[model samples]
Target: MQIMRPLYVDPAVPGMAFTYVMATGGGVAQADRYRQDLVCGPGTQALFTTQAATKVYRMEHDYATQRVHLTAGEGAYVEYLPDAVIPFAGSRFHQSSVVTADETATVVYAETVTGGRLARGERHEYTVFTSDLEIRRPDGTLLAVDTMRLRPEDVGGVTGPGVFAGHDHVASVHVVSTRRPAQEIADTLHRSLADADVLHGTSVLPEACGAWTRILGHEQPCVTAAVHTAWDAVRRLLLGHPAPDLRKQ
Candidate 1:
């Protein structure tokens, strides 16, 4: 496990503290388990990200698991934007992230999944890839839940009619904010992707707290670009600030 010092990169948003969690000892491997927790106090803003992409290496034994927990207090704003997650051939991995926030808190989260090392002719070769994300109020009332269980071998591969067909990368963004109109935000995000070379969609979440977006493309850059576009829209609508370049390598 690696933890790095925080940085003050955004002059326009001085109130939002940014931190990087460096993953040491290389990337995830077989039989590895990781847990992380983050808290944002009332009226404070923060951002969290990894130093690099999370690579799930090939495994010969048990699979790996990663769990993350986050808490945001009233009037707080938080964003968790990690790099892409690359699952190498013969890998099995599971990840879960849960966020508990007060009714007034706002959050933005994103994830990207690639079709393995396409240049090495690796695609849909992983044994299993599972991810679950949930958001809830401080009282434990669930506001939203998103789960993905992909087993290419059992499902006849990741590419097929109606299933990530012709797409080598996928990305998604979730924005939770009670201060903005959910449908309007969704419309704005949808418009932002009108010229992108990808297949994407957006919809408001339950109870109109916020919205979500999903995008599929043939390359990682395309999907990530779409996600960034959506994030820009969210930032403008919810935070009234422009999206800052993270400058990730």
Candidate 2:
């Protein structure tokens, strides 16, 4: 535990939520960051988020890495929704997550990123951002496999008509709920964002198949608003109330 990290959370919320960074492998880091930990108890509702965009600075020796562990209790719902991560040039980082969910649990989680503040001449031309994610049931069996990367030459990023669609700031929302029809929820979300002055799209997958939504636009404001709109609509229909915990500052 040589690497010191900042871990934050607000248990006073409607449910339980936390985020922090802790030492992982024996790798020597040129610097440190705040890691996150999030969870929920039976029948409890929780939302977890980062205070701001997590920045991984350049490393001259070895790779800086993070591992996240998440769980949701029976009849509980949780969201670890974090904003985009901006990596500076030459920075190397690896992120991985293992999420376990009970049969009665429901979750909506997402992670996104931008190249950088291009307006101010900031760009992550030669930087590398990598995240490997997996979802599992209570028994520890696998449910999904996701490998994501952001680089100048990597096609490992999102694509296709249902994916990024040429937008810079992109998001992937994974909702696990059976209380309501996923298709109906996505339909209403699309209709809600139709008139907005933004370019975006949404999709609904099968029950065991998690759903995905892609929003592409220039400004983060528009993209963030559109995502919130969808999250809000789905929350009311499924959780019996808007996600008060997911609201942004």
Candidate 3:
């Protein structure tokens, strides 16, 4: 639970501040519980990301859970794009995130999960992994909801047709904004992945709030690149500029 001072690292969007969240412990352990809350003031531009990938160690007893809440004020633009989460064998983890955005604000959120430590041949060896995401207006009206529950021991398993579909990594990006038409946003997202070597899909969010995309790939690099492509496209479309390299080693 540590945070680094915000920096103005994006030349394209000099007004946007970049902040990095760091974990005191090396990774999550059994019986761990964590929570995070992020708020963007009116007309502020900010981007929040983790310093490194989150690792969930093997658990012998209870499970680990994380909760996150994000709020965007009027005319604010916010982005929360954390690194991927990797679960070790026999680990169990759950995460829930809720985003509240004003009618005039815009928000971009992204998340990625791996099958496990691919180098160690730990593919979906975890006991269970789950995540839930909800988007809402300031008045509490819901805009969209996404839920994922993966259990390799289940009957059909997570590698079935509609789920991960045999992919070792999966990523998702959600954009909530009024700067562009929802369909156009979806189109931009779809076109961004056109040349990427991965399987992906895009659609407009409920109530025409924005657009979202889901990507699947066998390797982490490919999946990550696709997600970045989509994010860059959305940035160009909404902010009229390309994404700046955060220079994260």
Candidate 4:
């Protein structure tokens, strides 16, 4: 893993630093184990993103796993918005993310996953793809937990009514913050995607701490646009500013 030097690209928020994380191997291979820990000190404002989409290559034997732990200190504002993850045929992978935040901190986290290489007509051909996410307070109090297990060979398959619902791409955004009322945050998220081209839903987080939204669509562009809309809404509500263009290549 390589982290680029901090860049001040957002004139609206001059104090916020933007950093990009790059994978030296370009993609994840079979039998790979990766871990990442990110800590934002008190009163700091930062955003971290990946240089490109995470591609999980086809596997034959063992599976790949990635673990991420994020901690936000008091009054810190941190965002981790990475690109989509594309699992090739026969790939098996699992990812676990744990977020620990102080009551006064604000953290925005998002993730996107595609069914497969849609251009190549590969859809849900992977053996298994699972992810677990947990949000907790600094004192170890659990706030929320989300788990996803996608196995095309399962009893009902991933395209079932309650699962992907035949969507090719899925994305989610979570905002953990005390800067605004939870219901207001949820409403903002909902309004952002009310007329969008994708299917989405928003709800307040546990304990009325913040809000979150989930988006699903057959096209990647539609889903990605909806995700960005939700994020921008939340940013405007909490930070009094809009989301900046990362200018990613």
Candidate 5:
């Protein structure tokens, strides 16, 4: 089955929650499929999340796929903060998300997957797992693209220097704008990022008329927590939202 939701971007939603509920029994049968997507309109703000870790039931041959598409218009902001994804024994899954925003827009996105339920002492033993993310501006201006993958009996490539850099969880926050004084904002964020535990960095993309900040950490929750905090800082410094009312925890 397929599910989709569209919410206005203005006033952003409280706690900005996005959730999905499964009705089928445990373990997906062969050739089964599930899909979900979200869309936000101009001047709108939203945050997307799922109730709990998604499970990929065992599949020996074919892999399941999930595709998400988002649209944010001018002066809008959205965050994709879904819960963890869990792949069960011998299962395979492919995940991809693509987004395009107007010039005056902001996006904070994060995705995480586990080899298996670790509490059950499961190690990395999946057939295949992957996540592909990309974003651009209204005029087809590219901002950033990331592709990550893992397989059974092989070391995951998320730890690459240009990528996750040995961190299990990966996240990226981007702001697209043509406003001047880019240097000033970049400098301030750099100073505020002092002594952060995660390997974090920020860079401005004038060609795309925006900037991007990336954070890598050992735990998924830690990476998301840091992103939430950074959002608060940016809202306070740039958007002028008070500390608590910036982005709901």
Candidate 6:
């Protein structure tokens, strides 16, 4: 694994700082394991993101795994947005991210998944793909959990009415903030993507901590744009500001 020093970016919200550039040393390979831990102190704000898309190469041996642990202290704010993950044929991979934060803390997290290398006509050819995300309060009370265990062969097909529904890319975003109303945030995001070329849904999370959104689109760019729309709405609803361009080259 590789990690670059965090740089302060201009935050849309005053007093909130942002940073970047943590990534895997090399493309993920069979039998590889990666672990990352981040902590945000009280009243601090920061952002974390990967340098590029995570590519899972073909595997003839064991699978690869990545685990992330994050902690946000009282009144802290954090945003974790990683690029999409693309798995090649015969690849097996698993990744999980868990966050523990105080009730007053806020977090915005997102994940994107592509069917495969679309240019190569590869879609849902991976052996196994599993992912899990969880959020908990400081007392260890579970707030939300999102899990996906996908096996194309066993599922008959990865894209269908019940599955991805013919979409080549899928994205999800979660907003956790005690300061705002969850239903309001959900409504805002639902309306934001109503006319988009993507299929999406938004709902409030358990305990009313915040809201969550899932979007599916046939094209990578459309799906990514839809996800960003939801993220932007969340920022506006919670921070009372517009989203800033990440300026990711």
Q: What TM-score would every model get versus the actual structure?
A: 0.97, 0.76, 0.99, 0.98, 0.71, 0.95
RMSD of each: 1.1, 5.2, 0.7, 0.8, 4.6, 1.5
What are the runs in model 3 whose C-alpha is more than 4 Å off? none
Give per-residue CA lDDT, model 3, range 26-89, as digits (tens).
9999999999999998998999999999999999999999999999999999999999999999
Candidate 3 structure, TM-score to reference? 0.99
For residues 1-249, could you state the per-residue lDDT of candidate 5 as single tens digits?
323364333253344434333324454444656555566777665666554567787786677887777777777766666666777767788888887877777665656565466567664556777878778776777777767667655654434566545555556665544443556555555555665667778887546455667777776667656666666665555555532322323
Model 1 CA RMSD to the hidden true structure, in angstroms: 1.1
Measured with C-alpha atoms, the lDDT of residue 237 in candidate 3 is 97
Clashes of 3: 0
lDDT values of the candidates?
A: 0.88, 0.64, 0.94, 0.93, 0.62, 0.86
Residue pairs with colliding backbones in model 5 are: 9-44, 9-45, 10-43, 10-44, 159-165, 159-166
Highest lDDT against the true fold, candidate: 3
Clashes of each: 0, 4, 0, 0, 6, 0
Sort by lDDT, best first.
3, 4, 1, 6, 2, 5
What shift in Å separates residue 63 of candidate 3 from its native position after superposition? 0.8
- lDDT tens digits, residues 109-178, model 1? 8988887878899998888999999989999999999888788986467687556787888888888888
Q: Where is model 3 poorest over a 10-residue stretch in terms of lDDT?
A: 240-249
lDDT of 6 by residue, 95-126 (tens): 99998889999989899999888899999999
Which model is ahead, 2 or 5, in terms of lDDT? 2
Q: Candidate 1: lDDT over CA atoms?
A: 0.88
Model 2: per-residue Cα lDDT over 30-101, one tens digit each: 454434455667886666665556656557766677777788889887777766666655677778887777
